[model samples]
Target: PDIELHPSDKAASFSLVLKGTSDSRTTAYKDPARIYGSSHSEFTARKRLEITANGLRALAAEVKVHETNNEILGADTDVGGLFAGMARNTAMKKARERIPDAEALAARRVRERVASRLNQEVDASVTSINRRLRQGPGAALEQHGLGPASLAAHSTSKELVVEASLLFANQLAAGSPPAALPKGARAVVQIHESAVNNAIDQLGLAGQTIEGAHVRERIAQALAPVFGTSVKLPDDPEQQAPEGSITFAARAPLRVRFVDGQIEVILHAASLQRGNLKTPAQVIRARYQPVLAENRVTLRRQGDVEIRAAEISPEVVSISLQGFAAARDAAIGAALRAPMDRVFRPQINSPKAFTITTELGNVVPLEVTALESRDGWLTLAVR
Candidate 1:
């Protein structure tokens, strides 16, 4: 697989394509865990941790929820997906029942009320903290260049801790049942011990290592038990944030649901295209960038020759396909030739969908589509 990253300014984003690769082959060769199993212990452990962390995160979630609740309720608030997540959970249902027509207008209203009450409580705490940091005791620090104790500053600081904590808590609470361990789940099932152990460990430790790390970090200085673990949570948006730049992390491979089964493409490269090939002294010569750090840039790139067919009218096929956008200069040239003379229409290949067109600006659709880079050019029957 060839991978390349062109800066957005340098080029329009290219969708990577994998040819002659199947999920079976990938599963057997690349990621067996994804194909056969996942971290079940981590998942189970997460549920347990979420329950424990609820108290920790609730303190923060409540404040932020309160701050935004009133504003959202008063405005055109849509809690459309907020509670959609655990709609099956009884706690969520009961929480929503406090407001009538939760499926309609009242869901946001209920949330608003909750958020408003919590906001008032948060405001009170902020006020108390500010007073102490000001004249109560820490006046010396504020007077010096160290820090100034203002209610706003105190609220901001508290907000960060509470917000981060609540964020983790909400994740924990997300799939939680009204109670833990339903009575019927105590059966001793036949399964691999390693698998069961793995699942359990995931359920217990994954969330803490990933998101709960923030709370652990904030209390790091004072807590002695928390050793060797950094308080900084990697998934937290605010932590280590470069100014004005947001970071998005990919935890796993992107699973694409396809018609036959499912096709998973591990795109190590930003844009996946079949590199153009030229032979230099019996070696394939192509110049392009490979996505992998180890294979960053290739001096002479060689790639498989793809089949391309164009079916535009001889007169205007050149203008129609060339003018239409393309993946490469070769694509533009192939479309300009209008080679597919016998088919019903000009067939342009696309991985997800296919479009058929003519020189007269008429378009026909085909179910059997092809990838843009897979084939060079195949002209179809022009209607």
Candidate 2:
């Protein structure tokens, strides 16, 4: 058997050719003949058969995509075992012609036996292949929300080819087509920024308040350099404040935007408190350059986080110098940077985050060969 592959921008084609030959010899008794007082004469029959089964036209499958349910239904052209039957018939005709006594009943029996065995072999091979397909790639595709949109098979001078177009289930409703796999890459997964934001939303990060004694302490420490006084952040908003201490709290959901080859994280609102006085909400914007190394992808902070202050000033703390707008913004940005880094680093930098575990319990470590963020999409090419 020979196998070949042809790949195009939209689809991939595969070809298989099965060819073999068999020989057999049979000893039988002929009709009674008077040969030196012998009642019957014996003859040896030999037959050599050559078989070539081309799956170019015989083996074909079509996959219909059901986007709503995220399912793929396959329709095989050889549902009736037509290819196996044809191969059996061809083998039988050739085997019978090779036999010395083609018209003999014995020859007919031999031909039938040869054809039956060939048919069984062909049928078994086809069945086994189909079973493996269903259990292997088929299962993987379904698990990953991938379905074939179009399937076609054809033959060239030297090969039989099967071509298919595949789609991602989640992208169908958005009318977004799958990107072409990069040259020499085994697979490519394109993640849109919107999908990332949606996942964040599903996790209930939006409107969620992040506050704790340890969290407040960390932020307070980060602000110490600019405040010139040790800050005390209350763990709860309603808790009584210590004298001259300032409280800071940030609210999510954090939204991400991919553009200009970077990931921009926006924290919509943060508030600063000094006793009963609280400043208006502020926005924090952070940008990161995504970096891929070995099997891990991580984000490197591009620069200092941008702090957008509201009309009310955060410099009203009695322990700090008043009316210094720039100093207040810098203090808030510095306080949030470390906590944000802690939140994102572990999530994206781990190698296990990108590893794929297959249904057979095999771990496939993905080595990201290329990473690109453009046009609101983050694409990763892996081998």
Candidate 3:
């Protein structure tokens, strides 16, 4: 079989030419005498059949994304076959001459059979491909709270090129089409900051609040070793904490922004309370530089998280308590940084995060070769 691809902007067309031959033999016997059977004669017929199918046209179909699965539209193909040749034995010469245009009739029958078989095979292949797609990439996208926003496919002389844009679930499919994949790269994934934020929203991290008692307990646990003693923190606003004890409460929503070749996480706290003192709302910005590793891309924290007081003076406290304020700010920063790192480390640093499995059970590991973040898009180049 020879296959050729013709690609246009909207869809790709394919033509297939198939050639094959088949041979078969048949035997028949006739008894001359009934009761006193005297003799029997046997006749044998052999034939070699050749068929060629040309202009079998197949077109790349449109793909639609659904909630539970995907749909393939216009998956029909046009098949045409011709009976090229047929070799018959001498024993079948008399039978062949008895019918008018016997060869032509045989050719038509063979052509019909070939066309039917080809159509069946094409249908089966399409069904299998559709099922595998739904089970593999479709399921994976849903797992990450993403779906295809738009899809287009075209056939080049060498291959079929497919381009698709992804959107977070429930997000409106409105955006400029993504840029083409980088040359020589097997695959590239371009993620927008809004998509990341949507995933975070799916995780229920936005507007999450930590109770003061829970916050104080975690702080004490973290500072116990540094202070060389177990710390007891009081959460009541009216109660006074011991020298090393602290109480904290925060309600912050996590958001991500892609800018300047880095990812900046903005944790804006709407309410923050420390024991009897209620501090003004603050913005905790953590910048991460994306670094490409052997099999994954990780966001490494650029520096200590920046704590900026929102709508207030730079000083976290009065001048007289400068020393105490410095220590308090350090502890609070440490507390905030730990959990954020924990939440992001597995997602950003693990090689499995860049791996995908096909329905055929083939594992394709995306080895990160380059990473770039700018203009609200984070692009990863994989080999």
lDDT for every model?
Answer: 0.23, 0.46, 0.48
lDDT of 2 by residue, 183-209 (tens): 665556666665554433333334433
Off by over 4 Å in 3: 1-6, 11-180, 198-206, 210-252, 272-280, 311-348, 352-357, 360-366
Q: Which ten residues in a row have the lowest lDDT in candidate 3?
A: 32-41
What residue runs in model 2 are displaced by over 4 Å at the alpha carbon? Answer: 1-181, 212-252, 270-280, 294-296, 310-327, 344-348, 352-366
lDDT of 3 by residue, 31-68 (tens): 21111111111211111111111111333322111111
Q: lDDT tens digits, residues 1-383, model 1?
A: 12222233211222111122111111111211112111100000000001011121112222111111101111111223775334324333343343333222323443444445544554455455455445533443223222211111011111111111111211221111111111322111111122222222222222221221222232232121111122322232323311111011122111111112111111111111112321111111111111112312111112322223223346754655664523444553243222111110111122322466632345855332111110111111111
Total backbone collisions, model 1: 39
TM-score of each: 0.15, 0.43, 0.47
Most accurate candidate by lDDT: 3
Candidate 2 vs 3: which has more TM-score: 3
How far does residue 56 in candidate 2 sit from its true spot (Å)?
22
